[model samples]
Target: MGSIDKYIFKTTLASFALVLVSLTGVIWITQALRGIDLMTSQGQTILTFLGITGLVIPALVLIIAPIALMIAISHTLNKLATDSEIIVMNAAGFSPIRLFRPFFLATCVVAALVAFIGAYLAPDGMRRIKQWDAEITADVLTNILQPGRFAQLDQNLTIRIRERLPGGVLGGVFVDDRRDPQERVTIIADHGTVQKTDRGSYLVLYDGNLQRFEVGKRDPALVAFARYAFDMSKFSQGRDVTLGIRERYLWELMWPDEEDKTYQQLSGQFFAELHDRFMAPIYPFAFAALTFAFLGAPRTTRQSRNFSIGGSVFAVFGLRMVGFACSVMAVKTPLAALVQYLMLFGGIGVGVWMIVGGVVVEPPPRLMEAINRNNERIARLFRRPATA
Candidate 1:
């Protein structure tokens, strides 16, 4: 790279990093707040809360990187224009395509990062999140009951205690379980403690009475025991590590197991996700090219670039929305995925043509005149006479 190219590359990359981190951090905090219950109610530490919540960062970056790249390219181009550097370069025989080299390299870097996150990092993060969430739920069920409150451990199970005693003993324990439609079991114990063995978790109740009620009969079977072990492992088991379409790895999406139940039921989703992953890396390049084509020209101070900038942003947004629509429709019709590819490549082609042909993107003179007239009328309405 030349010295000029290196300067533009460094500036654009620095801007990209700053924008990416700022935007990702803001969004991550909003998402992480949703998991605050882990620390507030589940007896988990702050570090655990952040760790589980932070796993979502890879997924967020998969969406934010392309937008950040576009913003960085726009900023670099605007700065060059503001400093009249673009004009100087143009006078020195530099073409728009020549000036676009640094931005292209930066966009490529961001695109690769997005591709990596989408293919591997995002799926792995989602898998870890599911595993850790299941484990934490188990721990919460076993150890984190609040005193003097009724806790619904599951849809059909409710547990309550009068007070929590030291040494992990629970006082005034009551458990109502209706998981089996054919029967209901209620246990009232004076005191109990949770125990975990190699097999599973159990609630060891002392001085408790168990009442079993069958659905057909009104009368209940009651038994009093000095010590009883109630199995608590059923609630915590079988909830770990299930992969959805979004959680599947790249190769898994490409060559999914034909016999897998999820693949059978959600085959359409698999098709959509596979195409989305393949197409995600193409967006950054399209965005960079469009931005340069719209705002890369040398202009005098009197010429406003606002319309061009707005046009570029609108085009980028429209293209992305089309891609999203195509991805959605691709779930049912596999051919819909081809639309996004066509749009992206077409955008690149148009941008390149405009850049190479030195076409200046501007609003029509009539439209600008109408806008100026409307602005003047609004300004006149807001203006007041000054005191003499």
Candidate 2:
């Protein structure tokens, strides 16, 4: 790599990093907000909330990196053109291929990053999310300890508290249990506390009475007691965690087990996810090439690069949208997945042709020019100062 390659590569990488971070931060904020109740309503700490929600980031970056790379390329190329750096490079006899090399190397880096995220980080993050959810569900103290609301431990058992005071005291306790076929049990107490141990969690009722009713008779039996303990072990039952196609590793996705409960009855999604992981990493390279095709050629005019930028964006978006559609169809037909490969190659082949042929694909300038003239006219009318 020459000094120019290092410079362009460094500049593009810095811009790419900035764009990726900004876009990912905006998206992560939106997604994190949806899970804010994990702290507000679930008695969870802020760290817990952030950590749980942060697990989705790798998957999100997998989707955002390609778009960011494309934008960074357009930005860098446009800046170079506007400053006449591209013209100087062209006059100095720098071929398009040489100028394109640094960006292509950057594209390779982004592609590798995408592949790692899609194959490993994303799946590992998903697994963490699944594990976190499972842990939270089994945590009675954190998940079901909300004050002044009825939380059902099971279909037959529910517990409520009027107030969860400071120092771990519970006031106005109510318990309803109907697991027994022969009777229903209702317990109310003035004060109670929820305690956990190795054995299990238990609701200790003080100065309370249990009212048990016979299933078929109206008469009920009241048993007065100084203290009673209701076993709440059932609430913390550990459920078996099942890994889905999204959580599976790359090799697992390639050779999924039909008998695996996680993938059972999800054949369409299985194949689709496998192909998507493979296809996702290719988009970064294709998008970068497409940008080079649009803006790599030298231009003498200082025209706005908006048209070129928009055209590149549209092209990339169209290709990706088609790839996604094919992925969906591939679920059922399997053969439709080949369209993704075609889309990848077609983008690169067309981009190479345009770059070699000195083609600059830009949006229609006439439409934008007309809109700009109308805006100028409106501004002039508003600034006439006749009213003064």
How high is each candidate's TM-score? 0.80, 0.79
RMSD to truth, every model: 6.7, 5.7
Model 1: per-residue lDDT, tens digit, 147-204? 7788898899999987765445678999999999999999999998777788988888
lDDT of every model, 2 decimals: 0.88, 0.85
Candidate 1: where are CA atoms >4 Å away?
A: 139-146, 150-236, 376-388
Put down candidate 2 lDDT per residue, 1-388, tens digits, no spaces: 9998998999899999999999999999999999887766664567888998999999999999999999899889987888888889989989887789999999999999999999999999999999988877776755676778898877888888886544355778888999898899999998876677889888788988999998788888999888898887776667678887789889899888778866778878888899899988889988998989887888766566667777888899999888888988998988888878888989999998887777867656798789889999999999988764
Q: Which residue runs of candidate 2 sit more than 4 Å off their true CA positions?
A: 140-146, 150-158, 162-198, 202-231, 362-388
Candidate 1: deviation at residue 237, Å?
3.3
Return the TM-score for candidate 2, rounded to 2 decimals: 0.79
